[model samples]
Structures are given as C-alpha cells and as structure tokens.
Target: MSTVEVLASVDIVALRMAPEAQHLQVLLHRREREPHAGQWALPGVIVNGRTPDTSLEAAAERALREKTQVVPCYMEQVGTEGNAFRDPRGWSLSTYYLALLEPGQVVEGEQLAFFDLDSVLARKVLLPFDHNLLVELARERLAAKTVYSSLPLYLLAEKFTVLDALGAVQACLGQAVNNTSLRKRLERLRERGWVRDTGEKNQPRLGRPQQLYQHTPQGGRAFMFERSLLPEGV
Candidate 1:
C-alpha cells in the first residue's frame, strides 16, 4: 500500500484600499523558489509540530509577519482546500483565511505587490497554486458580506468621507454604485446607529466639501440584503 503524507498549511487573502487605483488591491508575493518560481502567489505557511500550542489564527499571524511583514486588523476563516494534487511535494491541506489591512499600513517589499481587483479578474498578471481562485472567492465574500456586515470599515480610514465609504463598497461589489442610493444607505446606516457623522468635512478638489463619517461603537452589525443593490457594470 502506498502511504500518502498529509500536511496542513494556511493561506491569507489580504485586501487593502488603493485610492491611487481608485479600488481595492490584493496582496501577493513572488515565489522565489521552485515549483512555481517567479510567479505571484498568496503568502502561506507550513503547519508543523513545532508550534503545537499555537492556534491556526496565531499561525497565520506568524506566517504573515514572517513572510511579508504585514499584519491585518481584521481576519476570518474562509474555507479549506485539500486537493491531493495541489502540492507537488505531498498531499497538503490549506486553510484559507480572509484578512483586511488598512492602506498605508502595509510595507511592500520587492517580492510583494498589490494588484487591483479589476486587473486581477482580467488575468493581466500571473497567479499560481490556485491563488487566483482563492482571490475570487474572497472577493465574492467581501461583496456579499458588505451588504449586511460592516466589513468594509476595515478598508476605510478612521474618519472617512461619503465617497470614501462608497468607493470601498463599490470595490467590493465590483459594480457601478448609484451615488444617491449609496448616500441614502449611509443615512439609513446612521439612523440605525451603525455609523455616526464626525462633524467634519473633506474639501475635495472638484466637488464641494463633504461630511465625514465613522463607524459607531456598536457598528459592523451583520444582517441580510433583501434585494440586489449593485448594478450590472462589470
């Protein structure tokens, strides 16, 4: 009987706000070693007996810090993949985690690069080891969860303008969001105590001064969306 070796690993899908690109970007690192050398891939770590007491979350944290020197403020388990052919070395199982990092917080190295959602979806860049599929799944989750949960807050500044909020939502949904509809949603969110006006305004170069808002202490409430809110832009 041929015995297969089973190993466990973790992969992170870190998203960040990219104002310069006017969208969100996913963090990826270039694989320097073999198997998929010179290809962009998600940062991951091998799980072994060395960190016996360390939980999966802790392991992921350690992995991100060690591999990329980036730490996310928000993280949640997405799912797991255990295709026997996934790893060339042996049968490996990877537990995927979705993490969110604020812009200006990440320090990018020569090996690390951020690719915008549109470019990623367009396959303009190369991604190996099923990393592209992982990104798509993570993006879907972000879009679906934003309708209910305040997950997009992680992609915004501490104090943000209405456009900032809307842009974040648009990046997640990958659709053309109606400005008026988004403003109404923000107002409704404030009325529900999910967010609060900060009494500040952002002076834009083109438009008039806009009010700033912040998530309330009891924000990020998870609910359900009754209807499709995003337009078919993509």
Candidate 2:
C-alpha cells in the first residue's frame, strides 16, 4: 500500500479589473518548473511552518505576497479541499481564499496575466493540481456570499457612487441587476449600516456630480440578505 503523506498549502483566487478586456479578470501564473511546467495555475505556496503567532490566514497572506506580490484589499478563507489524487506529490490539504484587488493594486509580473472569466472557465487553458477547481469554488463562493453579505465592497474603490457599487456587484455575478431592485437594496443596506455616505462627490465626464459613499468597516456583519439579488444560475 502507498503511504499517505499530508501537506498543507494555500491557493489564492485573486480577482482584478481588466477594463480594456471589458470584464473582470482572475490572475493566473504560468509554472516554470516540474509537476506542471509551462502550464497556468493559480498563484499559491506551501505552508512551510506554523508558530504561536502565525495562523493559516497569515500563511495565505504571506504566500500571496511571496508568489504574486499583490496585496488584496480584502481577503477571506472560503473553504479547504483535500483529496488523495488531487496532488501528485502527496495528499494535500489546501486552504482556499477569495481575494479582491482594485484596478491599480497589482503590479504586472512576467509569469502572470489577468485572464477573462470565460477563458478561464472554458477549459481551453491548461491548469493542473486541481487549480481549476479552486477557481470554480471561489467563483461560486463569491457569487453566493455576495448575495447575502456585503462582500462585494471589497471590489470597489475607497469611495464609490451607487453605480460603481452596482457595477462591482454585477462584475462578480456576471449579470446585469435590476435597477429598481438594486436601488431599493442599496437603500436598505444603508439603513442597516452596511454602507455610509462619505460626504464626497464623483464628477463624471458628462453627468452631474453624484454623492459618494464608502463601505463601513464592520458592515458585513450587520445583515443577511433575504433573497439573492442576482440571477438564478449565478
């Protein structure tokens, strides 16, 4: 019988804006060495060790910095996956995190590129070591969590207009939201303390300036959505 060896690792699902491509893109890195050389995969790292002060979340953050050099505006652990055949090296337990980066937050790396969601999901691009599973899990988690939580705020700029907030949410959902329903939802969110007025204004190229708002630091904990604002399959 083969001996079962366990290893711990972190896989980051990093999302960023790609305006030129006209869609939100996920960051993927091409491997240079063995096991999956020359193939694209999610940026990740092995957990070398743990200390009294270091935790799994900390390990994930460090791995992200060491590999991708991008510090996300917001990050949270979504789930953990372990399968006997998932890793050829051995049995591996991978902690998955969903991370969001603003437009200018990432510095382009040689081995990294922001890929459109469709391209990544189409399976035409090669990925190994269950990396694609991590991406799919992250996508579903983000969409589901955003339905009931204020998690989409992480994708927005420091201060944003209502349209900007809607756009961010729409990007994650990959569908257009009902304007009236969204307006009502935002109003309710504000009343529930999920968002607050920033006392600032955003001047568009043509339209009159609109008031701006920022997410409350602790807003995500304040409420749970009664119904999903997104489409059924999202």
lDDT of each: 0.77, 0.76
Instruction: List clashing residue pairs in candidate 2.
Output: none
Mind giving the per-residue lDDT tens digits that candidate 1 earns over 1-234? 124567788889898988555588888888888779888888988787876428888878877887789868678888888876777766778888888887676666789888786677677865776777788888888888886556787777788888887888887877667888778777876888777899988888897999999866352334344544664443
Cα-lDDT of candidate 2? 0.76
- Could you give candidate 2's per-residue lDDT for residues 1-234 as a string of tens digits? 146558778888999766533357888887887778888888877775553227888877876777788888778888999977887777788998988887556557688887776677776665788877788889998877777766777777778778777777777777787877777777787897777887889888999998898777562342467887865775
Tell how far residue 60 is off in model 2, in angstroms. Answer: 0.5
| Residue pairs with backbone overlap in model 1 | none
Query: Residue-pair clashes per candidate, as listed?
Result: 0, 0
RMSD of each: 3.0, 3.1
